[model samples]
Target: MQTRRTFLKTSGCLAAGALLAPNLAKAAKVKDIGIQLYTVRKEMLEDATGTLKKLAKIGYKQLESARSDKGNFYGLQPKEIKKIAGDLGMTVRSGHVHIDKDWQRSIDMAAEAGQTYLVCSSLPSEGQTVANYQRCADAFSKAAEACKKANLVFGYHNHEYEFDKVDGKVLYDILLDRTDPTLVKMEMDLGWVIVTGNDPLAYFKKYPGRFPLWHLKDMDKAKKESTEFGKGQINVKQMLQNMDKSGVKYFFVEQEEYPKTALESAKYDYDYLARLDY
Candidate 1:
């Protein structure tokens, strides 16, 4: 999405400057930056309201929730989550859910939460074969159509396993080819893609505008665990520069293996994205 010229105004120094310095900060930024609730799972589980308020203060204005043991919305009702975030100048944008037999309830809950997208956090079926992937695709189509009727979008988030070679073919790519791009959108996890020895840019090129959501994570290349933003191997700036090709509307920063407290790591991640230009 093209950013408004006025939105480019930022504040920092010149040589090392990143703000209002249009020359330094350059064009477009991820306005309404978001975070996956899973990143702050511990804090959320402890105090959902307080934790959300803290994220809002750090300038993360959008959210993507995960299905937690405490239940969706971290023990709060769907409307309560929406109300709380809205009270803090943030929005509940998307959520990670399982598209299982209780999917209709998920759709209902997501709609009630006032979020735009309901993402299947993992594959519904349990096999890695082409037939299995195809079956998943068909199921996804049906699920997405149901979402369409409810005025919502349905998508899937990938782990490294999706890119594994099956019958000499990339299973993730096969699903992409098999599904209707309009119906079943994808939420590309950059860290997983990179860790799996795949190129996210290649996917963008092959399937332009197919991805609308992303998990913006940085992984410790050596350990394959998530770390603070700039401390990892993901070329975040490069990816941001080419975001248009990926058709990204919103991306949620996620870090599972933190160097410190989850909340502290979250704050570090928020600031990292804040200073970047692309």
Candidate 2:
């Protein structure tokens, strides 16, 4: 079973031994540098194909879309987006889906986009209470089963709300405890986890191999809000050290609030991660 990393290396691009090197000397681990396409939503909406090409040139190999609207892939048809990615030699590993009406259409759209995973980026506002969360958990269980039938992994992305206390227990913990682990994996957004006043490492230690994907963003020191990966207070290097145990297979860079241009923020994240000892 060849992994994406293996496929890229076997394309006669890099030595096999270089693929596993921790420092990633020459972006050998392309999947390691995935971009949450939501970061460039403005550019993507303007020109999906051209944006993908530019991202490929910038060294981004994998992509995670926030969501599709009306059968469109970031504003284009799923098949169109897939073809664009194929032409540019890019991969769409995962995408954001919703918990509402005709989501199956979205699933099929993702399949058309050549995506391997469909992630629920948020819970409906109605699913905000304890009972509602439990209902959402049940829905996730069913959705996960559906994803399995479609040969796609299903996951949930988190926000600060999940960390709030309900009945003296963390809502996030309840969601984790209630959801069928085999059915639903997690795409932990590191920035939101920190913002919710939780320790990212602590959750990793507790969950242990449950997080297959991560949103690697940072929080400002003064504002305590999200910033570019390097200029923020989150200790990403320390967090990344536990990837082996945390089951972090894919990590996508995300910056909801750009201090400057979003591309500049992404470049800073890329340059900083590249320089890390890993």
The most accurate candidate by lDDT is 1
Off by over 4 Å in 2: 1-31, 68-72, 125-127, 221-224
Q: Listing every candidate in turn, what is its Cα RMSD in Å to the true structure after a full C-alpha superposition?
A: 8.2, 10.3
Estimate every model's Cα lDDT from 0 to 1.
0.90, 0.79
In angstroms, give how far residue 246 of model 2 lies from its true place.
1.1
Model 1: pairs clashing at backbone N, Cα or C within 3 Å: 10-20, 13-17
Clashes of each: 2, 1
Lowest-lDDT window of 10 residues in candidate 1?
Answer: 6-15
Per-residue lDDT of model 1, residues 106-219, tens digit only = 899999999899999999998989999999998999999999888889999999899989879999987799989988999999999999999999999999989999999999
Give the per-residue lDDT digits (tens) of candidate 2, residues 1-278. Answer: 99998897777565655665545653332235888988888877777777788787777778898764433467777777777777777788899878778678878877877888899988854655688888888888888888888889999999878888877888777768897777789999988888777887888788877789999888885676778766778888777777777788898988878868777777777777777765
**Span of ten consecutive residues with least summed lDDT in model 2:** 22-31
> Residue 139 of model 2: what lDDT?
86
Candidate 2 similarity to native, TM-score: 0.85
